[model samples]
Target: MKPSLQLKLSQHLALTPQLQQSIRLLQLSTVELEHELERYLLDNPLLERAEDYALAANAPTTGDGEIAPRSDAPAEPSESASPDEESWLGEEAAYLRQPGSFDEDDDDYHDVQAASISLREHLLSQLGLMTLSGRDQVLVGCLIDALDDDGYLTQALDELAESMPAELDIAAEELQIALIHLQHLDPTGIGARGLQECLALQLQALAPDATRNLALEIVHKHLELLGNHDFQKLKRLTGCDDEALRAAHLLICSLNPRPGAQYSTADIRYIMPDVVVRKLRGQWTVNINSDAFPRLKINSLYAQILARQRGSGLAGQLQEARWLIRNVQQRFDTILRVAQAIVDRQRQFLDHGDVAMRPLVLREIAETLGLHESTISRVTTQKYMATPRGIFELKYFFGSHVSTEAGGACSATAIRALIKQLISAEEPTKPLSDSQISEVLGQQGIVVARRTIAKYREALNIPPVNLRKSI
Candidate 1:
């Protein structure tokens, strides 16, 4: 109960700024690492990216520590440079000689479109073409903004009217009218409040026919039954023949459920493989992608100045530049080592397919590399490998083990691939159920549970037996 001063000795690890930067860089994805590098490039004047780090590194240096000029009349272009008869060395060398001499027709100089237009912006563009009063345009604009990414206006008419400024003097009735106008937008179902209304709007757009009428009725009354694939019950309730119901179901299924999703402004992220695996002389070799790496160098001029004057701004930046270069190199080195280990262990997967993927975990790679599990996890998180099949995340090779009858462990990924194959080969009229699939695997010496099969099936996005059944 009494507070007293006590002497205690404790041992703990403290992370330095450089160590923190290393950890952060190790975990960053390709896009994030690019942004981080750009930030450092902007903040530190002592840091600069090397156009050809390999060439600079190999180029002979004079005794005074300066890069010596080439004495040869001319040197051959790099293998990476594309050949061009019009240029002296090559297309790459020509561009490098004149930085602004980029050809518009070149793939690297492609004029990519700006970010995708949002659903609201698309609706507003259509509205701009219409000659409407200012008040009407404002009402429609508000309605368009209220609609969600799926093109459904989730808010109620009353709520929308209440949120508007009092000076506008808008009413729920006006909002309801605006909602109807929004439903007539280019997307066909932009202002629908719910799934039922969305389908109904699409039905209205179809030509007047018995199929459309039946489909409209089905959507209005028994969407739940249609979703359940209770064709018999739907036929009974709708009092339509089998052929007619089938036609109506087909028509309904053709409608877009999420019209606005196509116009989503969300940026499309591209994968940059950290390591590339290629087969050479009947052996798989893993190599780090030079393009994925950012070649960095310390500004020799600033570095020289900082050496004479220690404890200056330039000195701090110089140290940071060195740390950045070292950390980036270490990141790629770790990635290459991990990828090689994976390729070595799962060579069969590359040679054959996912069926040959062995059961592996992060611990295996961590222990093999003499690193911690957390470090391995960070390394593999966003790292990717390019192979003959396709690009795959480094983590894709690691999966939980499932025991086999032969006393061997199989990867869950391999099992999922097997299930996908079984479903694909199944008869349309009588699709294989989860239990049947499990039994099929059991016959192949792999004893998987029915639920596990079902889980794997769902993960592969394979439909249930009822939904997969043919008409």
Candidate 2:
């Protein structure tokens, strides 16, 4: 049969471009949002940054519709100023009034980070000072190049020598001699093949003594015992008493396993909080961070031009720009609302620290703010809140729950905090095991299993009971 056209009336959800943009903007972190805005500014002539606009000083609003103070705004003297603020202002004024305080000509002031030398460069510099023959220096340089960032010679000398050109006549023995020379460099553990050798080299660098010898023996043979905190076996094997073993342990702990790490450049990232929590008039309040909030507006010149001409080519761009501005504002508004809801529920945590944290989930905050769980998840994913306790991701407040004996629920975060507290106060000779920690929490009315305690302990980067024990 031939198909015939049929008229049907059906209703279905469709996301408009504006709605899509709003959702996208809502999920982005503060840094990511800034970058996205910069891209928009580059693409649209009508969209421009309103950094110098007078309204910018009062643009940031808190959850209560009150203007949040700008970080860069000048402070005005007032009778209500606290003593500390008054003193700080007075000191600032004195500093400004001092002679030669202003340097108008120094317009090129900038911070210059000191250039860091890599492990290879450091080794070469030491090699330059040595009086070794050219052949020996070249062989040593080749070995230095083979070392990893952690200062460990992971490749065997035989393998490395085999990899070299046969015309160079390099041998494993020559590489071994070169290794000896390289190990004698400034970083004592530079050419070590493994952790045992690294610690042994450092130990060998120390002055000869009974303690040093014992530590050297342990490092060379019983390193696994020391690592497992099997002090009894170590004492029996080394024939050392408590005092001597303790000293040796301390000495071994002081040695750097990764000598080249100091020269390795670290990637340091900074987090900008979306909202700040503060206690005002005996109540917790949430305020948007001014620096993290994007200040945007339509370019006055382009907007005026578009208004003067009907159906201008930039009309679509103007509409797009307005949509972006509104979506950005809505983004921050949603963030502020969600953050305030979180602070309200987690006020106990702020007042009493992590131990007072209650069980929270995305559904709770989503229902409280009349938003979907997905919206709450997007809002909390990369967003951060700055509180008196510390800067934490918004998602950090929401965790799985554990049942309590009193017919209530406790946050997994709180249980972890309790476990940490118990471990921190445990006797060194006998650190609290996972089972013991579980019992301690059970006694506190929060039921946690040993496996969960171990998981949280590992998450906190805490070692196991066997590894945590001391001499």
Per-model TM against the reference: 0.77, 0.88
Looking at model 2, the pairs that clash are none
Candidate 1 global lDDT: 0.79
Error of 2 at 46 (Å): 0.8
Query: For residue 305, what is the lDDT in candidate 2?
Result: 86
In model 1, state the lDDT of residue 267.
64
Best by lDDT: 2
lDDT of 2 by residue, 319-404 (tens): 88878877777888898899899989998998899998999999999889899999999999999887656788999999999999
Q: Residue 114's C-alpha lDDT in candidate 2?
A: 40
Local distance difference test, per candidate?
0.79, 0.82
For candidate 1, the per-residue lDDT at 50 reads 70
Backbone clash pairs in model 1 (N, Cα, C under 3 Å; residues 3+ apart or in different chains), count: 0
